[model samples]
Target: MPVFPKISLRPEVENYLKEGFVNNEVVSASGKAAAERKFEALLNHLSHPPSFTTVRVNTHLASVQHVKELLLDELQQVWQFNGLSVPVLQHPDLQDVLLIPVIGPRKNIKRQQCEAVVGAQCGSAVLRGAHVYTPGIVSASSFMKAGDVISVYSDIKGKCKKGAREFDGTKIFLGNGISTLSRKEIFSGLPRLRGIGIRMTEPIYLSPSFDNVLPSYLFLQNLPSAVVTHVLNPQPGEKILDLCAAPGGKTTHIAALMHDQGEVIALDKIANKVEKIKQNALLLGLNSIKAFCFDGTKALKLDEIEDTEGTPPFSPESFDRILLDAPCSGMGQRPNMACTWTLKEVTSYQPLQRKLFPVAVQLLKPGGTLVYSTCTVTLEENEEQVAWALSTFPCLQLQPQEPQIGGEGMMGAGLSGEQLRQLQRFDPSTTPLRDTDLETLRDARAEDMIRLANKDCIGFFIAKFLKWKSTSEKDPQK
Candidate 1:
């Protein structure tokens, strides 16, 4: 039996995904039955949260051990499970990371009379350790009052109407919590209130809230995300570009990796997202990041070849390293029970990702590195893109990643065995499912626990390429 419902997708969308996983290449390698099983496993894992939460300590500001001790103390203070403590483990390979186990799916809890329905996105957050905010509450019991214990549920199918007295459509229980906002307060016409509307008292999954805990010293990053910068290997005094950097997670990591001594230019198309990048940089006390609001596809400035400092319209081959964290359909986020996107919407990212690749390649200097990544699972977005890039740009050569923690690339994209080995694909479906109860976690060895944390993270893909040919040496495409 599955622990959670397999992530809900439209019939056509689901069929589209099934095709990718059960393709000829995958079936040939693993056999048809095995490929189908893997696809089903991926679906089951998508609706569940990662077993552990990963935080990247800002080594530029504090040592991993210092931050680790501080975090251990903070979590100790917040540890609320019958007084049994959960240990915070540091990664063996990722020196700047700390892992905290997420305990439960707590199936034993009984449902309560009063009910509250949160949006799908908010429900995913709850499973990943977040209180229910007011704005996320779509429906609540008409007579439910503050401080009343209520069973929380997610409108997994998005069929619930706002301010509804009760939702009768498809929904999934997300454990119980105490209401902090009554029905009137939540549905009040004046304005949608912010902050916690339901303080989770018995959440299905228990992970520490990192709202303001060591904000400057800890970044709530996934294990694979922390690996991207290590692959980029940004050096001090060198210039790097992070295209499509919003809220600047990888952008700041690049700056921190360089010891805040080099320029890390980050660009996102949205003004508010650019502001968020700037805000995160300020919050982390990283002074080396320069965020700009500009379209990455049009970032190259070949008309006038000159260094433009850290602004848009940069000359070709200017940045020592470039990171194209291209936007995609986002099929790989964990605890996501539903994706309402159409087939066209799901397939729309390939062209956009292709557009950003040339810009990243052109912006990178000769012998510089370019790392392209996405948080999606499609062959088109991950492995197919790699094959396309190799064919499209003769100057680009796929490079080996430093931390080879994730499995090799998927087999459907015509990439050779060696080429596939060079890529990293964090497929959650590969790991065996196991109980994450507190006792199970406590009894597990440290190495085994860390390994589980790594493979059970969000579905992500990364491919590193080196621009081997110098501008003066050849003009093959030009």
Candidate 2:
């Protein structure tokens, strides 16, 4: 049963998503009832976190088994402290993935009047096993003091004003927690405390906090996000470009796959996010990654250069491979109880993605690979982009992805069955999580859990393309 109501989007956005899910192709293929059911399931799943917390073991530093042992030891301590136990399972397909089941919507979690309210983004993090940090806290009870037990709730509709005395608007209880700072310290203290504001003693969902846990050897990543790197299959001593790579999850993964022997150019428009990419690369001990703050849409240069150095705006077709994890309307993110995006905002990413696509194709060398992915379920961003690329770039040819664990591409994008087979879409709602208690989960086969970990992931889409034609031979009309 769904613990919360279907995700509350602006009425127009909701209708748009519903229509996309129940399009003519989907209805004709699955029947109207099944298509509607799938759409409803998606709405329900969006308000709940994924069942498994997936992490990628930095195999360059330690083997998967060694990392697993270390993580299990840490989890044991976490469980012992919290008076709870959860099984950690390794993926059968992904050599470097570790999965931990998330237990949720814990019944009878005691609520209190001393309430702490967090923003929607913060609440999503809390649901995914993060403590409520000071920056995320929107409000607290007027008299709420330090160390007082309180009930944490997410302002699902963005109705709670910052530092407000109380919020009565639509909110969902996250769980019971103990305040780390008094209301004054949070709202009025000089510079304000920046650490944990609410230590979740009883979260609606229980997962171990990964803060500073095996910093060098483990990267907390979604399962499908990790899959993109493997599918790219970067070889050692190759030059790769990651367009719009921040926090460097896939960039570092690409570097690790290449044994850190090749150059991986990571770019993001924002300077701070680029710094985060550098930081993550540094933390993972990956030296081959070069992160830059540059807009990817203008990354290609028409001027000829004698030699290609490691910077943006290089001569065209400089990279051996390129990964375009384009920005999208993130309708696929789980545990997003509500979104405040306007209809215009919801549909704004297609043009930006299109702007970046030509640059990605231009930067990729002949016979090189390019993988486009997004953490969203929009047809316009996923299958529609694929269709648009195929029509616009004759040099680009769709290729099959390795370890195709996700479902085939979604319908309503005018992609043929054969073409759609090459695309991967991980829709959480289509495959329901199998209910399991601690004992049953502990006794479950590792392979079974691995399968579950693959299917029941956040909504994601990936498509790999190969540049089989040289630029000279490319048709301008496409």
The candidate 1 region of ten consecutive residues with least summed lDDT is 75-84
* TM-score of candidate 2 versus the correct structure, residues matched by position: 0.96
Question: Residue 288, candidate 1: how far off, in angstroms?
Answer: 0.4
lDDT of 2 by residue, 419-440 (tens): 9999999999877744555676
C-alpha positional error of residue 74 in candidate 1 after TM-score superposition, expressed in Å: 0.9
Q: Model 2: how far is 379 from its true place, Å? A: 0.7
Q: Please, what is the whole-model Cα lDDT of each candidate in the order they appear?
A: 0.89, 0.88
lDDT of 2 at 68: 89
Measured against the true structure, the TM-scores of the candidates, in listed sequence, are: 0.97, 0.96
| RMSD vs true structure, all candidates | 1.7, 2.0
What is the per-residue lDDT of model 1 for residues 1-478, given as tens digits with 9 covering 90 to 100? Answer: 3577899999999999999999999899889999999999999999999988999998889898899989878877773444758888999988888898988877798899999999999999998888898999999998999999999999998999998989889898988999987788877754556778998888888888887889999999988889998888899999999999998999999999999998999998999999999999999999999999999889988668576765788887889999988999999989889999999999999999988998888888989999988999998899999999999988999999998889999998899999999999999998876667877876899989888888999999999999998644655697
In model 1, the runs with Cα more than 4 Å from the true position are: 79-82, 189-192, 305-309, 471-478
> Model 1, residue 289: what's the lDDT?
93
